[model samples]
Target: MNPSIKKLSDIAQKTSKTIIGLMSGTSLDGLDIALCEISGIGPSTKVELKNFASVPYDSAFKNRLKAITSVPNVSLQEVTLMHTYLGNYHGELILKCLRKWAVAPSEIDCIASHGQTIFHAPKQQHNQPQMPNATLQIGDGDHIAHKTSILTISDFRQKHTAAGGEGAPMAGFIDEMLFTHDTEDRIVLNIGGIANFTYLPAKSKDRPSITTDTGPGNTLIDAAVRQLFSKEFDQDGKIAKHGSVNADALAAFKSDPYFRKPLPKTTGPEFFNLHWVENKLSKAGITNVSNDDFVATLTRLTAETIAESIKSILDDKSHPPLYVSGGGFHNPVLMDWLRKLLPDITISSFENLGFNPDAKEAVVFAVLANEMLAGEGFKMESAQTENISFGKISFPN
Candidate 1:
């Protein structure tokens, strides 16, 4: 038998495997590395975060991604270079993290990397005929496996799109496994660069849980901050707290057809970026809005859209508590909007459930990798995500 295959066979038999999961979100902020020990398979799975870290990219690296991702067109060479560069960068980042965590590469069983999402244009967003629902995440799996010298699973979304999904809100498959409640219908709402949620019905048999991207989570706010104040993000949303939301601009922005689309929809900064915001402002005929006001309005827009999306899917008219995760929960202004808008709904951080919100997404990828290894043709299905085993594996040998 091949040495690599033998190693994999041995690793699979272990009771608990130490897996490293990496996530570089659309925010272009940094890479999230999560080391998780996951056991069991499917709904019987158990996951525990042993260590987690987010290594921020320096301005030069982030600028490179922005030039490649945020723009409509770019040099193909740079895009090609970025694909390889990001993979090697992330692999080295994982090695650095392993050193800091005082663990050897041999100690880890596998690596699950959610490569940087540069473009997420579903056919609905592009509106181009003959284009299937599409999305792109860079950072090659082969490079990661070679650099890390560990078995790696990457590019999990391709299978999702191929399986008739919008290739997003991939959370439901894992969220239901990790955080389902038997008596309480839980909404595991994640607000990363894009806001999405997993609706886990209390009784899994009666109504299957669904996951969907609500709309702009932190993407627009981050873009506006980068444009107005030359910052990657509005720290604690301080700028927005100082200003009032422009009702006219908010109304105009809400008029988008994307908001009217049905559930199981997906979107990204491509449709909800600074350019989109500026266009909305122009249509609203509001030219003199201050930076703070613009930021406030964007904040309001995210909260309103998220609230509305959640409300739209309540089959039992049951307003369940939201267990929130991701970067948006850190912004007090955004949190405040949710509180003020949905006064009766209980809003709490994922930390309340003993999971770091920042590390949740990374942990998810790790869980997915675990599923790939242990699934055993297990039936994994949700309303949005099809019953499919994702992630293309790369061997380091």
Candidate 2:
């Protein structure tokens, strides 16, 4: 037997494993590296983020990612090169974090990488003939294993898509395993470039829990900031705070058919990019909108859509505790709008529950790696529409 295979087999039989999970969300902000100590499996699974860091990307890397991500077309050469470039890039970044934390590479059992999402197209969203739901994430696992000299697991969404899912919002399984409470009905909201939520019904509730993407979280706001002010983000909603919401423009944007669809749907920048926004503004005949107001209205759109989604299914008399995570949580303007729109609900950061909102996605990938190690998967009501295990493993040797 190959030593590497023997090593992985040995680790699988152990009571726990030390794993590093990497996430490059659609926001293109940076890589989220999480060194997790995971144990057990299924609902009894336990994971601890022993160490974590958010490494922001330099302008060059961000620009390169934008060149391919969710766009209609791309330079085949850059797309091909990024697969290797990003894999090695992320692998080195993990090593840097590990060294900073004073951990040796050999001490880590495996690395789970959620490579950057270039595109996500569910059949329902794309509606192409003879094409099933499809999605793509770059950054090759072989390069990660080659660079890190450790077993690596990556490209987790393919298996979900194969099993009839949209290959997105892959949070339900891990969220229930890590955060479900017996008495508290909770909604775990992760507002990355695209916002998504996982609902955890109380122990006694007869309903099943689910996860779904709500829609543009920071993607539009970030684009607006970049296009108008030459900034990557609104910077604590400063630009938005200075301006008023454009209701006409907001209504026009909200008219998108995607919003009218029922739950369990998925979308990405592929569908919600700046062109989509500009077309809506034109359709509404709203010309001369200021940069600040553009961001403010986009921020409000994020908050309003999220609030409305939750409100549609939530009990009018009962306020479910909402635990917010991801970049949107840091935007005060977005958070404030959410509060005003859903006055009855209590919204708090995931930090209150011992997890950094920014690091949550990385932690989730870690938990998925742990599941792959255990050779098990839990049933979840999600996009995949079936119980499935994710991630393909690459051996170091």
lDDT for 355 in candidate 2 is 88
Identify the leading candidate in terms of lDDT. Answer: 2
Give every collision pair in model 1: none
205-323: candidate 2 lDDT, tens digit per residue: 75688788888999999999999999999888999999999988999988988888898778999988899998998888899788888899999999988988888778668688899
Q: Model 2: how large is the Cα RMSD against the reference?
A: 1.6
| lDDT (0 to 1) per candidate | 0.87, 0.89
By TM-score, who's the top model here? 2
Q: 57 in model 2: Cα distance from truth in Å?
A: 0.9
Model 1 TM-score (2 dp): 0.96
| Candidate 1 C-alpha lDDT tens digits along 253-340 | 9999999999978988888887788788788788988899989999999999998998888754577889899999999999988988
Q: Count the backbone clashes (under 3 Å) in each candidate.
A: 0, 0
TM-score of each: 0.96, 0.97
- Which regions of candidate 1 are displaced past 4 Å? 315-317, 376-386
